[model samples]
Target: MEDPVNAMLCHHGFHPSMLAWCSMHQLNLGIMQDFSGSAILLLVRISFFGNYNAEDHLRESMKECTRRFKDFCKLHSFECSQCWLTTGMLHDNQTGWPSLKLKAYNARIFLMFVRAALQAAKSAREAQGLEEDAELSYAVMAAKALCSWFALVERAGRYLTPEQAAEQETAGLVFLRCYTFLARLAASQSIRRWHVITKFHGFRHILQSARLTLYNSRFLHTYVDEDFVGVWIRLSRRVAHALFEFRVLCRFLLRLQAMRTVDQRSVPARWS
Candidate 1:
């Protein structure tokens, strides 16, 4: 079975079609019986399929799948309320269900982030001749999405024992990638809003939190490749440079203000 699956994946060039087929097969076989488990698998399929192809059609498909999955979960909750054994109870008997749920939640949040990013890019393009407020609104939306993602990651961390989580290098790498993504987004936003003092503070906070996430997962260095580490290093440098420039600007402003005050003090009394 593994050979056939691998062969099919290779034959299909690891395309969305292969993922769709596997998803449908799982559904038909009742392998993913629980709504939450099924939803998680669906999210994974969509993520894997859409990752390499970021077309509008792919985005729309992902959105539709997510909407349907959410509806399914809602309906499942209502049905479970009438049943003796709830989905929560069922999951309690399954040792790895919590981890699966967390991964699904992360995937859902990432989908939201992708949608927000697309919206922001579209707004930026359309706002070329529009008011700055329009662009700012999109920026705020993106920032809120990032905040939600960070919160979800924190929440997911609480689901597992610290020792068990530390052993999950793959999951740690996922978290690292997410942190890097958030850091890059914040750095870009900071560069655009350099004059906004509050944004620089936010950027610093994002960088610090990302660094902490990576530091906690530093043990993953042996598992990941050099390129992965290099990417983190490059992103860190970019963020650091942005922070450095922001600080320099602040100092320049302070110096200019001081010089203006000195010039005012040195001026002769008003010609009365």
Candidate 2:
């Protein structure tokens, strides 16, 4: 009899069906199963929220999921095995499955950022009901979270091997998603904050990171399914363009404000 876990591994990296199978069987398949299951559940929850206009209850559930996943990562921090007996033929004792481990770690990091983004968004939204000072406090919290996540991504490169870093599909998707989130956050702030232009530099950093990830993943077009690759490319390009345009608008607004300030000062001097 074939091991069910190995069967699922052969099918494709990790799929909903694989998670379902493990859930149905009540299997204790260790860290791989746990991490894959949590990641898939997070994806499912994200899909359920659709565009992240989530209801309060849905947001709470997302927070709960994030907490669970974080705890799981802490507990399993030292557990980095390439394969298990349950993986059967999929277990290559030769190459040692370093790529798989890297993918899993990357997924975990992606989830962490997503969780933080959600929390920040929620805090900003709730700030609308608070005092003026409270609102600024919440906005500052959101900005800090966004900056921290961007820095985390920069530091994450040290964790990857050259080959794992080159596997664009895995880490690349995470980068694209994070960049999109940051762009959206910037757009929201620009609507209310006149001084938001100061934050444009952070968006620029995310855009460059997204571009680098997409560039490295260009080879994915030939190897991956054409339709899937096309969709990824389109979404990435759309986000990149949106961020670029917003940054330009910010600079333009700042320049106009500076010019107006100089004109007002000169008018007062002429009157004097």
Candidate 3:
């Protein structure tokens, strides 16, 4: 290695393998792409003599699933109410990844994705004269793999049993193989938006990180920091620019103190 390169900070100078990734982000990206990627869309397209469209069938099924979950969320909003789920599960591919990740945190989301895929496959089977629908089968398999991975994620935040660690490794491997096949299918079909990228490789690293600890610990992701940034963005937009940084700090601190005061259990202070 050259001296100049060695002198750089650890993060900027490190090998690709040395860099860590956000597990939550990677999982959500892959899951989101599976349902909405052009490859999957092409695979879901039905070419039949009649008016039945498999893609439309799948879409409606997903919407129905989302509606059911939305109803459940109304009664228990704190546990599962996410903006994307409340509106509809089909988020725009352009700028909706954050909202998609928030939806992914809700476990009922798996039912919608997997249910729609399975229903589409079943419809293809019931179509009278069609041969084996390999593409639909591929979508079904990928969706199920995603469902399996999501279930694994929902098991526990930290300190998994040895059995659970083994399951995580197996789920990661199956998820990779399913998506690699879909990428190859995309190649054969000349689909434009479904090529594999390095970000997907982080899932294995996530599996490693998930099993690395020996005991209970806080979650690896810094969601609180993300929440703080979101709050600041809203605050900055609404406030005047003068003393911007100081105002933000003071207001943030005040908000925190007020929250604590409102929630505290001590008797209210009285002035005699």
Q: Runs in model 3 with CA error above 4 Å?
A: 1-20, 47-111, 123-129, 214-218, 232-272
> What are the models' TM-scores?
0.19, 0.19, 0.56
TM-score of 3: 0.56
lDDT of 2 by residue, 125-166 (tens): 466664333323333343344344334344533233344444
Could you give me the TM-score of model 1 versus the true structure? 0.19
Q: For every model in order, what is the number of clashing pairs?
A: 0, 0, 0
Angstrom error at residue 202, model 2? 7.2
Q: Report per-prediction Cα RMSD to one decimal.
A: 25.9, 24.3, 9.7
Q: Model 1, 95-153: lDDT tens per residue?
A: 43311122323333333433444454446545675544333333334344444433433
As for candidate 3, its clashing pairs are none
lDDT (CA) per prediction: 0.36, 0.37, 0.54
lDDT of 3 by residue, 140-229 (tens): 666666667667766544556667766766776776787677678767977553456566767767766656632111245554557789
In terms of lDDT, model 2 sits at 0.37
lDDT at position 75, candidate 1:
55
